[model samples]
Target chain A: MQRTIVFDVLNNDNGQVKAILGAKRFIEENPEYKLILVGQEEVIKNTLGKYAEKVEIISSNEIAHKVISPRDALRNQSSMLSAFNVLKEGKADAILSSGDSGSYITLASLKVKRLPNVSRPAFMPVLPTTTDKKMLLLDAGANLEIKAEYLNEWAKIASEFHKIIFKSNKPVVGQLNIGTEDYKGTEIAREANKLLKEQADNYSFKGFVEPSSAINGDVDILVADGYAGNIFLKTLESSFLGFAKLLKQIYMRNLKTKISALMIKKDLKGFKAKFDYRNTGGAYIVGLDKVVVKAHGGSDEVAFYNALNQIKIALDNNVIEKLKEVFEQAKEGEDE
Target chain B: MQRTIVFDVLNNDNGQVKAILGAKRFIEENPEYKLILVGQEEVIKNTLGKYAEKVEIISSNEIAHKVISPRDALRNQSSMLSAFNVLKEGKADAILSSGDSGSYITLASLKVKRLPNVSRPAFMPVLPTTTDKKMLLLDAGANLEIKAEYLNEWAKIASEFHKIIFKSNKPVVGQLNIGTEDYKGTEIAREANKLLKEQADNYSFKGFVEPSSAINGDVDILVADGYAGNIFLKTLESSFLGFAKLLKQIYMRNLKTKISALMIKKDLKGFKAKFDYRNTGGAYIVGLDKVVVKAHGGSDEVAFYNALNQIKIALDNNVIEKLKEVFEQAKEGEDE
Candidate 1:
């Protein structure tokens, strides 16, 4: 049976037409998957051309006009709401978007709703460490002001998400902080640390993991408030880019170094790929009723394909169903 | 013409005797500068042997016993207080310590006091970016809770420090945040951004700088609350260490890669030196009445020497006096 995957393509860096057309090959390759393009009908027909007939189109006039910022995108929410409505009405199995993340989250939470006992959904992205391991960082940018209870809930959600996705038992959860000491962060972190410790039987709670150690890839899941988590993610991205730029300058210094660079070009590519965010497809908005993957706004064709594959995995694995069961069991235990 | 530098050696990672012995060569080389060792008398004699006579000693049994953590170091501050007392009595020009930073900061602020109109002092460290540029990051770990007013004053202090150290006429100051947008951070960051904008005439305010962009060497000064600033510094350190480990694994993979690594050993060393924290010495405690450089607890002999050189530069430039003059003028403006 072919499962339908709806992609919102209104607010990406590349125009809607380009982003939609770029996904043509992905739709063609995944014949078992049904592609539903949700945006302006005329533009989809004009840009998608003959292939427009191969995929379903959900026309939306509300988001046709340009939105200047994420805040603006949230105000005009026609396309996102329509796409999410497809999932709400059982017409689609999953939703993928490269548009404004804040808008996607806001719309999804309103229309799709959260799982039982979950206050807010977190943006969980899997980032590759220097080693062979990959760690899931949560609350990447979903909520600005996070309470200790939010971090506590995020930990439980992330642990379940990792187990289902990575098939890991007893995953280590660490609270992100400036230092590894138990007493080394803001008031929220301190309170969260205590909560994590109390729930040690549920998950393996590692003490505070510094930002630097977090990248080393030892911990299974790193939890933080949106502000700190977003800063850490951006800093890692910038550092890798900066380092790549430095390597380019070094290799291009003289003909001798250029020859050396050419000799080890294959090895260098493998090394660089380990730090590329595109390889992970996209960050998942966990704790939601439906699977929502927010692909990077600047994603290319290949990156977009990877993001689609991520949704396929989530739907196939029944991740949300499993999480709901876990939360319900925990709620019942508390009631007892 | 001679200036006396008091070195506190009680709570360093290496024992007090070993740290004192490590600086013997520095004392011998700088014949014009007097070295005052502040520690237990018996320990100094046991370590210095014959050369103990050449250097002055300020013995204190108060810090003879062991102190375990930074909190403990703060409470047991005999050696630190003794060293600061030398500065207070007009007997020493500068003070250097490798003990607990919290202890050093607390003792310095209490005895030395802050400059006029300065509410809180900051720990400003110079770090090298990917480029040839070096940046000053303030409130590195000085205050756990920072107000917007502190950031405003720290910017003024950093601008003056940059002028004296880097010889820049107008230093570009950037507020550290998760994003560069005006509406992209916490309430404190939003307020600080406005304050920085208003004081644009005092310095070249470059607006908010992301942690990633901050390390690219574009801005002269990067300011943040203690929590974010400390995390950024630690993350950079951890990332560099992680990258180096990855490179080692890559180079040691096979004989061919090993041969290639040998060919670029010199180039790699130069590249690594550019990001070395030791090259810029230790971080300075700015806005204090006297010069205090908190050298790294694990600093080697060479790193300690560089830290001493930093103090020499600050003294020669009369940084504290210049900062007082600037703050006094600003106070007058506020009154008017």
Candidate 2:
């Protein structure tokens, strides 16, 4: 079976040519997959070379500029919007973009039908943790205001994806809060905590977790209101980057330290590799019918290639189909 | 100009004996100051030695256990409560304790009156950044629910303290949000953003900032609602600690990296010292009548010594009195 991915090859910082480079490499490796390249038609054809004859290209030079309102995304005639249109028309099995997150989330939510029982979609990203296992953090910045039911809904959907992505039988789900105590956070967090506990049969529920829990890799699927989750994600990213920069300064201090750095450069490289964005690919714009992913804005050819593979992993495991089955079955039971 | 500090030498994880050791050192160094030690009388006298003759000891063996409600702290007969009472009755210039945070906050706010025009108190900690400067982060978990005014109120009070502590006349202030965009985050965040911008004369306001701003030391005082501020603080600390642990694992993997680690051991120690809790000493429970500082739970002699010095800087600078004058003068203007 051939799977087609709608690749929005414009709006990324690195330019369309590099994105096209990524697409060409992706097609060469995965012969069974089809590509729907949406960007400058001439550039796409020119860069793709030998693979140009195989993949379909949509001529769209207009890139989606970051917009304040979600409604504005639908009205735009940008390449990102055009790509979403292709996915909406069922011309592709999955969609990937390195466009503006706000616009991408808007288009994904508006164009793609929600999975059964999912009221609002969440931004889910598989993040590297201290442990060998990767952790899935959701609502990374999509919904700032959420209700208690949203947590329960997102948890049920995310747990299914966690099982597929991490291959864990019963992934531990934790609600991010200011503290682990029962009465530690806002009313919404506490309310969500009680709601998650009641219907937590499908996965393991860790009532409330603090930032240390995320750092220690104490939970598998960490769910939070978009505000806290997004801040946590950004803080974690910037802290690690900042720490690495500081570490670099230490190693470059003097000849003695510089020699010490050279002596163990390979091990340091290996440590750095653990945090490579290539490994995690991009964040999944989850709870939609299609396998929609938002690639990093600064993604290079290698990053895009890995992101395409990430979407492939989701499609191969039939994660959306599995989630639909579970939620639909639960609905049927309630109706009965 | 003799000053007295009601030292609550209990409820810390390190035990009362360690706290007494810290107080003993503090009293020895600062001969002009008096310590109203609240703990087992025999232990306080026995440990303080020569300094015991100079200081006052409030005999209270019970430690302030963590409480669910603010009212519960008022009812407790713990040494922390006794210490608060000492500050309450105009017996001490300031107070220090390594007690339960919630309980301490409750006692501090209830026992000590709020500064003029100050509606609520906040937790302010001096945090280390990559730059040589230290940052002041407030509302670190005191108010989970906040209005637009709380941020402005906290900012004014924190700015005064920042000036006293860091000796910066025009410290840069920033509001921590999900994003720096004007349109991002909740209604309160946007409203607070506007409110802060309007009355940001005391300190240089940097509108909205992300976690990177804090990590890079781009701002001096980062203000937020208790929930977000607390999460950011915890995440920043745990991330630094987590990275260190990971770095340690890398160094211990083999003999070569181990030798390299030894070669750069002193530099690493210097880096670690930059984040020592002992140096920052403790978190100041701001917006109160007196200088109320809650020391780190695991504080040793040096940490306690530094925390005492932190209080001295505040008292010596007359931060609380200066804040009172500023707010009172502002209130009088509003009435006129």
Candidate 3:
């Protein structure tokens, strides 16, 4: 089950240094995975000292920290592109970047290309389960305009990935919308529901699901377009912050409240940990010819290390190949 | 100012009886507001008992509840229609209903009519503040499709309302959008920003405000279309519940956690109190000729009573008249 994976590190924020250190530490522990850190030569080398000899650093300051547009990746010829090149050269399994998501998708699609029969690449993050491990949510902010057929494909792809990676026997794929009822969404969602139901034998279609359902581990795979999914994820993130801020206000209210804070400090930490995006790692841009993961903007070493771990599993399972097979079969079935 | 106001209370769910009882208590404490409990004669009498005499219970078993559409109010014999008749007759200063919001808006608009120069009615709710106190968030779910001109009017009306209600000298009006940048939102929002800026003398037109900014209490009046506002309100409600649930799970994890929960239980209660929507009166359907409030669907008796309290204030201030005056002044300024 052990697999070797390359880390395409982009020098953007402090997250890059953290990611480098995380990948090195992970490689040191699991000698099966080889580490390739790509960014500013001196910066990557300085941050990654002892493991510096073991890790390979690809240098290119072409790409700046914060990419303004997807066009910038093509025009600027930045570090992100250099790391992407490594994947194109077959030297690395997949590229993981904490840089601009739009740029990541743009570069991966134009350079790495799409799997046969795939229209658009979808970014899916595994949201940590409130009780158990995690659930994968797709189109977090990748595919803007998606068809019913595309969602069906996403459902199939995510189902196979969940079963293979998470080891779920029969992964439940739920189409997300404003409501769970059949006729509760926009024209696209409603149409998608009908189409997905017709091909229920191909995948486990759990009907429609609401935004609240996504957080509760109701389904193994939650599907939606980028807009709704973006709002869903951002809301979760902000809500976590809101609750944290509220807790701080309560504890800092007065001397009595401060004294009481000691008692529930551990409990509060446990509560906050459930919403920690860091533990889950970066979202994989699924339905692509080659694997690409978009790490969180504020990701630390642990999160980056986790992304590297994700890359290894994704590579070993040949997710892209499995997805391609599903796409072909699904398309043939549709035509018939 | 001691004022006598009547409530056309609609008993929709099991909590209706309690809500009525809470209003009765408030009526007794204030003696300023009289209770007009409208519904089935038998149920109202059974619930209120001796206090039923004080409350003028007009018999109408055919009360439109959740199952009934807002259009059902158009039916002559419906209880909701009968309640509006009371307001029309000057029997009630302001009508408060905990029934379906859509039905309330539909009937209230027809019965009360729109304020002069106001093309569409708006509903504004006082969202719970993360700051020192709460602020008004307009069109919370009133008008779905609003023009730039309508938003400009909304700002003026909201500013005047805030001055009378919240007592802000120069009420800060902000158009809600994704970001604060010059060109962050849709065409409607961008134009609203422009219009608001032009009329800065009337409304302290702040720049675009984010969802977090609304909660952060940076502005007095936050205006947006119903669709976005509905999503925003629901997001906040769902998030509060989700976070509370997470905290409960953490505290009940083990004996140690339970012990910690006991220590912070008081502070946690205080923290949650900040978000208790029950304290604030129900949402006001603004721009209507007559004053109307939409109490929370799951609101208890205390919340209902709080809503009834606002009825008298709305009546005394003659919010409808003030809204008309504001609109006239705006038109005059345009003429000049």
Clashing pairs in 3: A62-A78, A63-A78, B19-B301
Tens-digit lDDT track for model 1 on A1-336? Answer: 677888877656776765676567677777788888888888878876777787899887665233335555546657777788888888887888887666776666666768899888888888888878889999887786788888888898888778777888989998988777776778888999998888765579987998877898879899998877887887787777777888778778777777767777778777898887678668999888788888888887777778888888787788778779878987898999
Docking class of 2: high
| Model 3 per-residue lDDT tens digits across residues B112-148 | 8677788788888877767766778777666666788
Looking at model 1, residue B265 earns an lDDT score of: 73
Itemize residue pairs with steric clashes in candidate 1: none
- Candidate 2, pairs of clashing residues: none
lDDT of 2 at A228: 91
- Candidate 3 on A106-167: residue-level lDDT in tens? 77876776777877778888886455757888877676457887887778778878977787
- Quote the chain B TM-score of every prediction: 0.90, 0.97, 0.91
Overall local distance difference test of candidate 1: 0.80
Choose 2 or 3, whichever is better by lDDT: 2
The clash numbers for all candidates, in the given order, read 0, 0, 3
Cα RMSD, model 2: 1.3
Q: Considering every candidate listed, which one attains the maximal DockQ?
A: 2
Q: Is 2 or 3 the stronger prediction by TM-score? A: 2
Query: Which 10-residue window in model 1 chain B sums to the lowest lDDT?
Result: B64-73
Cα RMSD for candidates in order: 3.1, 1.3, 3.8
How much is the lDDT of residue B106 in candidate 2? 85
- In the range B1-336, model 1's lDDT, one tens digit per residue, is 787889886646766765676557677677778889888878887777877887898877565233334556446648877888888888887899887676777777766768999999898989878878899999887786888989999999999888888888999999988667787778889999999899765579999998877988879999998877887787777777777788788888877777777777777888888777668788999888788888888776677778887887887888888888989998999999
